[model samples]
Target: MKFFNKTGKLAIGSRLRMLTEKITEDAANIYKLYDIELQPKWFPVFYVLSQGEAKIVTDIAKEIGHSHPSVSKIVSEMAKQGLITEKKDKADGRRNMVTLSPKGKMIAEKIKDQYADVNAAIEQLTAQTENDLWKAIEEWEFLLEQKSLLTRVGEQRKNREGSYVQIIDYIPTHREAFKNLNEQWISQWFKMEEADYKALDNPQGYILDKGGYILVALYNNQPVGVCALIKMNDPVYDYELAKMAVSPTAQGKSIGWLLGNAIIEKARSLGAGKIYLESNTILKPAVNLYHKLGFQKVGGRPSPYERSNIQMELIIKSSPFQKTAE
Candidate 1:
């Protein structure tokens, strides 16, 4: 406990394992007190069989949240102790069904009272605590299911490294990176169209020289992402957010978000009132990122690329507001 206090949350796995061992040891002692000749690990299987239905090892494992091999080992131990009987399944000859033997059934009947007592004791213990451990554990499990511990740690690592990432104006050096990043993503999802080559092949002539701007995200002084604000001649929209791409390795580091905000600022500085973007619905993450940057879905826009099926626009405001999304 003192070591855990010093190490904090980093030793959570070790602490949980230690706690489980203590509980398991106490459970074994409790079974002995009940005069039940059963291993603590085999109780779940025994209880399930007591309900009068034969089950296979796979079913038992699923019901008790254990692995197939673990349940198989416990079944073998119970069989060796003459506590369970196994027979070929009538429905499937290759499969074997398991059920409690006479000795196991007798022990199950004797443990009914013990089960009630243990349930009441557990309830009393939880009621005495300031916060119910059972409910707290359920909440923790739900949160972990939403975002796994590995994903959370990966995001933290990305955020730490993100400090070294810089958003800068596009230059000749980033031309190859810009083309390759966009091409990689496009070729993975959709075929590159003539419009893609026109812009990606010559970003300066097609976008930058035409009263537009491009922003590049550099992580460790290397280009990882690119976003372009192409000048539009439409009546409602002043600029189009186009050709946004990030390297697969550099994803989840907020590079796309950084480039998006920088390009929006540049559009505002150029006296732009609205920014538009065309994207496909299949690119869910990209569409979500656009929405986080204050872009709203719109209709009635013609696209040069066949892959574009959705259009969005953002209204530029005079004062900058803090973004809430990462």
Candidate 2:
């Protein structure tokens, strides 16, 4: 854990540079393997046009951060390939409007499929490594965004059941079950402070008020576990995981496991790339659970919690998940 040391600045930078090269190499390999003749820069240009609504060539160039000449050349080549068509703008005839041609649309669809395949291949190669990479990126981005940004706020565990788990959302009137789970955590580890206990009790007031979501597990019509999706306004990432708890009665039954997977799936569906959480080291089961669920530990940062906490994060993607019963 050299990166965790206060003097680990060099180690951290080296690690980041290595990751960048690896990702770049991976991208190049994917394009070669797929036999995609389209250059990396053209993907964004074609993607923008495929989204409908004719766009001015200049605007497309600006949006993708490419120079006018560069984009112009690429667009011209695409037109020759019958992938796109350019027309003079009616209001400003000097400006050219770009639209995807039939061939262009087909190419766009193929690009989308190739993108999904690349992601699947990466996931298969890295497994949880993807999660760790995202967590590091989010943490670094957060630090750069806020001068007072803190890291390593808590530790979490992985879901016991593999990747797929039954998830439940919109569990109104399940406050009592969650309260019971909080009590179980307090009794088994350390008593929950009054404030922390209160936060768990009022999910709507404490969590949802901050643009978060509450989910609970049910068995035979009984509440079994609970977790929340806490929205982060930080520019680094859009959401965080908070106030996760499971009843001691349901501990060995993988209730929390399902709850964790459900939250991860929900976050991914919402277009979130990273999820952060806070927990204590004393909660060994919880720590291990987060790891199993693809969460990784990072440097500690300041937070409202009084306990010695560890922070964990999971990277999410748009991979399909099985629909759960309502």
Candidate 3:
């Protein structure tokens, strides 16, 4: 406790692990009191099997959010202890289906009463605290999912090493770097359509000459990232933020964030009210970056690209780009 107090937030992982170890120790005693021969670590797999459905290791792992090997290890232990039965799946020969044994079913029935008592005890324990730890943990999980600790630390690292990065207006030399960067990431995930080639082949003719603007991110005088503000003919949005790409060698350095904020500021300077973009949900990191740039999802518009499954827009009139993570 004293070490944790001194270490403060740096000991979060250790603190949470210490709490789990304590709970597990108490749980072992509780299982002994109930006379159930079950391992505390096997409870999740056991509970899943007790629901009356035979599941393969993959399905059990997905449902419980554990790994395939982790669930398989517990299932093997349970089978060895005569608490569960494992058989080859009828639908798939490569998979093994697992279910509770008769002894396991009897223990499951006995555990029902124990489950109720433990729930009541936990409720009483939580009621003694000022805040609900269960709700806090849920929120913490959600926030972590949105932005991981590694990403947060990377942003700080970017700020510290940002002197080498420069955001400047597009130049003729960046044309090839821009197209190649976009093509590299696109081909890895989705095919580049005709629209991509038209712009990537000639940014000046397809975008800039049409009243659009492009920005390039240079790391140590070498172009590594690019973003385009395509002038849109739509009434609601003034520009379509498109052709954003960062080289694989330059990723995780917050180049995307810097380029995105620079583009938003460029849009504002051009008197733009709103900006629109199309993206696929499978590009999770890109979508998360757009969300960080204050983009909100919208619908009812057809896309020019087959890979576009989701659409997002950002109102730039009132929303000033704030580098929140940095």
Candidate 4:
């Protein structure tokens, strides 16, 4: 009986380890085929060195989300392979600076070429299904992020309950709630014509179809705010955030901030490099929110709508608030 139990557990553990080993073996094969010497552990270190100066081992560990001891072991292995060298930091005796050696630079250059090749191979493999696959992945990732945020917010509220809210995806059921909120916003700020308001209301019609999204804020299960993203056709920028609205009752409670930030986070997660929004001077609070979120004024462009107004753009990739949103 004891032998049988031990055999059963060993079998299960062996199968799990075998699966993990297979994945590592496949990745190693790819690296070998591409003549790339850097393994998963070495890639980040090589990436940092390729960027500029030798980084402290602790900094490398932080950037790669690894323990210092783990990074040190990898670095030591890399040094043995003549891929990296460690030097003492002059100012800090405790820290060691890690730099790539000449052979490491050669391998890094080959890795860059292989990176493009691997992407091309993937593109070829998914040529027929890439669009749908990417869309599903994006939506799944977005929903996961929202769920994660809800959990974090819920935990925080338990400790110190505040005026926090989590808005989920916008679907047909929430259409009327979002429309009413937008109508109130237009009435107060833009004095937008019925047609203009109508166009904005059907965000799906205007822009939400092209990797765009609509999310509605809920308080006690009642929709009180809305935000939408529009993928830009610009060759330079990837997308823009637009159609942000919050009901007057929810105005001062930072609902707008939450909506704006959610849109930005979703955009960044979808690989958008920058995001811009149009607004008028009358909406000072909205503009202030944008500024607080690191948006800066850009040269005014003609509005698509005759209502025409001021435009502000945020370089999402460079914004300091990116990680917080993530």
Name model 2 segments beyond 4 Å from true.
Answer: 1-166, 320-326
Off-target runs (Cα >4 Å) in candidate 1 are: 56-58, 88-96, 116-128, 171-206, 235-237, 264-326
Off by over 4 Å in 3: 160-326
TM-score of each: 0.73, 0.45, 0.55, 0.46
> lDDT for each of the candidates?
0.92, 0.74, 0.92, 0.75
Query: How many clashing residue pairs appear in each of the predictions shown?
Result: 0, 21, 0, 0
| Residue 248 Cα positional deviation in candidate 1, in Å, after optimal superposition | 4.5
Order of quality (lDDT): 3, 1, 4, 2
Stretches of candidate 4 off by over 4 Å are: 1-163, 193-198, 318-326
lDDT of 1 by residue, 81-132 (tens): 9999999999999999999999988988999999999999999998888998
Candidate 3: tens digits of C-alpha lDDT, residues 76-189: 899999999988999888888899999999999999989999999999999999999999999998999999988887777878767678999998988999999999999999
Residue 187 lDDT, candidate 1, scale 0-100: 98
What's the candidate order when arranged by decreasing TM-score? Answer: 1, 3, 4, 2
